[model samples]
Target: MNRTVVRTEDLWKVYPQEPKPVEAVRGVSLEIQAGEFVAMAGPSGSGKTTVLNLLGGLTRPTRGRIWIGEDEITALSDRELARLRLESIGFVFQAFNLLPVLTALENAEFTLLLRGVPAEERHRRVRELFALIGLDGLEDRKPGKLSGGQQQRVAVARAVIGEPALVLADEPTANLDTATGAALLEVMERLNHENGVTFLFSTHDPRVMERAHRLIHLVDGSVESDVAQGVRGGVGHDR
Candidate 1:
């Protein structure tokens, strides 16, 4: 059975400065179980990215604790946190962030390479991931050659190629058209259902919230509401 993948206790993020600090996340607490798809929705500069950074181990909280399973990530060294992120978390950013020189397969293969997976296994995994994300025919295409949706598909393939327990997506559909964005989200939803991977995304789009199984709304750096799928009125389906 899948386990609870994330737990945040009174999480707080404050950007330090000479005078008053900017508080981004203020005493927020959350728990995400395996196979759950949760969305963090808020206006711009409302601590959504800060929350994502904290969850992905990219930024340590100024106060409180973040635990990925039993690991207290906020207490780890930078190197340790980096290693843990590499091994346990997959990230999808607003920008595709694919290397312009690498093909889709090569981009996906990069994640496996970082994990010390052998070339043969990496190749196998990359091909399988590409096929899973509907990027099979475009494996050899560079980011410049692929459409925005196709490139985002490659990014998703790269992010989940290793099947990490947690996937953090920050405004994943920000760059795509309506139809393409919906398709990309469907791919993510399918992945969560079929693979039991937990997804914690920071998004402000109605489309993103529409598909989420839960929406945690943030305002002024604190959680204003936590609504489950189907409990609130929305435009999308959650299964």
Candidate 2:
């Protein structure tokens, strides 16, 4: 079997509300292997976001166990959880959360800076990544000056800069045009395939579901199906 990088057993998340408790996620059990590109497909309020948040260590589960590698996330202190997130998880949000005052290159290098990578090395790696994403000449531009697609590319670069083992993309392409979004997915796919970066995406995008090697269909806070898409180990679904 492939090495399991993330595992969740009987996971549950409940939020207190005025009328009643909101059960956001219900008894989710999943194991994500190293380098696998998995997609979680569901409509709004279907627990997709909850699953992503749990996986990213954004919030502790109300019940059950979450493991990253062999470490149990639910057992860790908050500081330890934060450290784990810094070292092992890379997040790409739909908002493209680039620092407004930073240039594209600076945004991409932010994570590396936090990691204490020397400035010269960070610049070198940023150049290579910018070229990889076809944003070579736009490195000096800030997020506001770049197109939505460009900003998203910068976000991807930032996420990958740390070389985190797992990347959690939450509606990563929701803001882009069709062509741009497809290109962005291709870039992410290449990283997952060639660099062995595992990806777990929370998406309603048919394109994402189609391209993903594994489809995890969620409905009403429960898993409806967890199927291998195409041939065993191949991308099987498309819009």
Candidate 3:
């Protein structure tokens, strides 16, 4: 059986506003098994990004709990949460957040450097990953020198280099053209299939929804439907 890498129990997040409080997530309970390619889809303000932020330890929930591989993130101290995020979770954002000053290789290996990995080992791993992802000859280029698609690939390389248990991507393809987005999705799919890297994305793109093994739809801060897709031979079921 596959291990459960993420679990949430009645998760809620409310933002205080002048007129009234806004509920971003309500009573959301779900479990994501290891190596599943899942996507959360919804219209604007459906709490997709909020849930990812809550799961990634980027924000504290207004109420309820979240667990990543048996560790209750809701109860952890800020320091402990930071440590847990560093060791277990990776995040890919829409903006392709690479340091402008660093070379592609340097940006991709930043996480390893933070963990005190030796220079030689870091270079070896990044080089191998670059070659696998069609980034072999661009290691010395800076982010400014790369195209939008190339920058996003470098972002993905950075996220997966440390071999984190889960990667949460928030509209990673939002900034790319259709062709670029499709190529990026293919790269992620290959990683998930070949390396068993679990990916969870919150996106509005139909292309992303179509390719996901499982799709979870949200409306008005609640889960409306969760179904497995047929594209990857996934069994259909409600969560």
Candidate 4:
């Protein structure tokens, strides 16, 4: 079976600052299981994004270990880590980083194309995702032609099109209005339940945290609290 869980042990990350060393992530450890919809919740500068970066293989931790299933990722080479990201992990960014020149379908199919998925198979998969993401007829529309919500949904399609073991999304709804962000969150939750994909997202939005099955709060570079299902206020801002 593919590794569907992620684990971290005594993780730490520090950046070189001009004045003094700035610690980004402190002694934080946790496990996220398959199909879990988790939110890394906190205010700004709480290290949520830093932790997401470490987990997504976009950056390495300065100390400790990270495991995605059976593989320990902290020791991997840059090339190897890049390969791991392409193979096992998917990422959604706040800015909806779609290629401006590409159509929506093209953007969603980009990763599969890089991994050498055949054209017919890739199109079929992307078409299905487009339908699921409520972008069926807009498949050929460019990012600039779409609204913020639509663009973000396209980004979501791109992230999960290849069916990665883990999907890391950072501030996915930050650019959308309240109704649009809630709608996007619903789409993600539906995907999590239907596709059995594990999703870990960093957000300051209480609406995002409220929909999460689990919440991990970060403060001062450390995990301030880890709350499981049904604990809404454990790590969220007030409405």
TM value for model 4: 0.93
lDDT of candidate 1 over 1-239, digit per residue (tens): 54668889999999887789899999998777777888989999899989999988887888999998789998899999988888889999899899999988889888788888999999888887677778888878889999999988888888888888799999999999999999999999888877877788988789889888888898989988877784322233221
Q: Which residue pairs in model 4 clash with each other?
A: none
Worst lDDT run of 10 residues, candidate 1, spans: 230-239
Considering TM-score, which of the candidate structures 1 and 4 is the better prediction for this target? 4
Q: Estimate each model's TM-score.
A: 0.92, 0.94, 0.96, 0.93
Residue pairs whose backbone atoms clash in candidate 3: none
Assess candidate 2 and give its lDDT: 0.88
Ranking by lDDT: 3, 2, 4, 1
lDDT of each: 0.85, 0.88, 0.92, 0.87
Candidate 4 weakest ten by summed lDDT: 230-239
Off by over 4 Å in 4: 1-4, 230-239
Put down candidate 2 lDDT per residue, 1-239, tens digits, no spaces: 67888889999999999899999999998888888899999999999988989988899899989999888989998888888887888889998999999999999998889878999999999999889889999989999999999999999999888888789999999999999999999999988877788888888899889998899888888888887875324333332
lDDT of 3 by residue, 124-184 (tens): 9999999988899999999999999999999999989999999999999999999999999
Reference-based lDDT, residue 55, model 1: 89
Clash number for each model: 0, 3, 0, 0
Model 2 spans > 4 angstroms off: 231-239
Better of 1 and 2 by TM-score: 2
Displacement of residue 101 (Cα, Å) in model 2 is 1.6
Number of backbone clashes in candidate 1 = 0
Per-residue lDDT of candidate 4, residues 1-239 (tens digit): 32447999999999999999999999998878777889988889989999999998788899989998777999889988888888888999999999999999999998899899998999999888888878899988999999999999999998999898899999999989999999999999889988987899999899888889888888988988887765321233222
